[model samples]
Target: MWYNIDFYIWAVNLLVIRLRKPKMIAFVKSLVTPIVNIHYDFLQKKAIDEFILNHNGQVCYLRKALNDVFDNELRRIRIGSGNQYNRQYIYTRAEQKPVYLGKIYIRDKSAFADTGIDYIVYVPKKILASRELELIKWIEIFNEAGTAYKIIGE
Candidate 1:
């Protein structure tokens, strides 16, 4: 009876081992590995994407950071238009047209040349008075080395 009981216990252990789902564990691992790898790849590439070199070989990650920062903290400020030359709209009264005099003219100086400045941070009048120096220092700290920037109030 003791030998019979020991044999039965061994058989039960073998059956339990056979019942264990190794395939299911492998399937779960297969399903999860790609997801984990994709997230890891994205994190790695995100760090790379944040850094970029300018024409002068200076690291200009601030261009990307500035976009994010401006979008979040400085809603009233915007980067100037044009990649080659910065552009801005000016409101002025027409000097030659008396019939249209006193009426505000929105002028676009399309012939403007690049001013050798790298980045133009345009701030609305109200914010510029209060934060000009702060914005300048922020740009100085983050902008590419030796790059010039202007803070214009609109």
Candidate 2:
């Protein structure tokens, strides 16, 4: 009889342990989740920092990023004729003036030299009114070093 009771107690203990195992595992996972998230956030931040450092002052990258920023918007603005009905903006390349470099004069001066803005971005006045701040922030983030640009409402 005692042996039977001991066996029942052992079996019950084993059952309880088996049931508790999953709870223990879940508790451990809960504790680990925040740490994993912190590590992942740190790694993501580090990657962005590295990219900014390595991206340097490349105009091509800045231009491409700017184009992508507009394209990625939910409303899908485009670069084309700034028709009042169209959701679009126009980008004009820097106008360079002739500077004597060698046999031929190099066009180095921007057409509008009075302003520090190197590129002129014209947006539909209505769209610009609504999105000016947002567009300006994205432009600043992706601007090339020693280069500046202005966004005008057309």
Winning candidate number (TM-score): 2
Model 2: per-residue Cα lDDT over 1-154, one tens digit each: 2312333234335554556566665665566666666766777887777655555334555544555545445433333321222122233456354443344333333323454546656556766787788778766776657876656666
Superposition TM-score, candidate 1 onto the true structure: 0.35
TM-score (all chains, Cα) for each model: 0.35, 0.46
Off by over 4 Å in 1: 1-74, 81-114
Residue pairs with backbone overlap in model 2: none
Off by over 4 Å in 2: 1-20, 50-56, 73-113, 122-131, 144-146
Give the alpha-carbon lDDT of every model: 0.53, 0.53
lDDT of each residue in 41-133, candidate 1, tens digit only: 776776645442222223334544444444456555566533443354444566443343344445344324455555567667765677667
- Cα RMSD of predicted structure 1: 16.9
Instruction: List RMSD in Å for every model shown.
Output: 16.9, 16.0
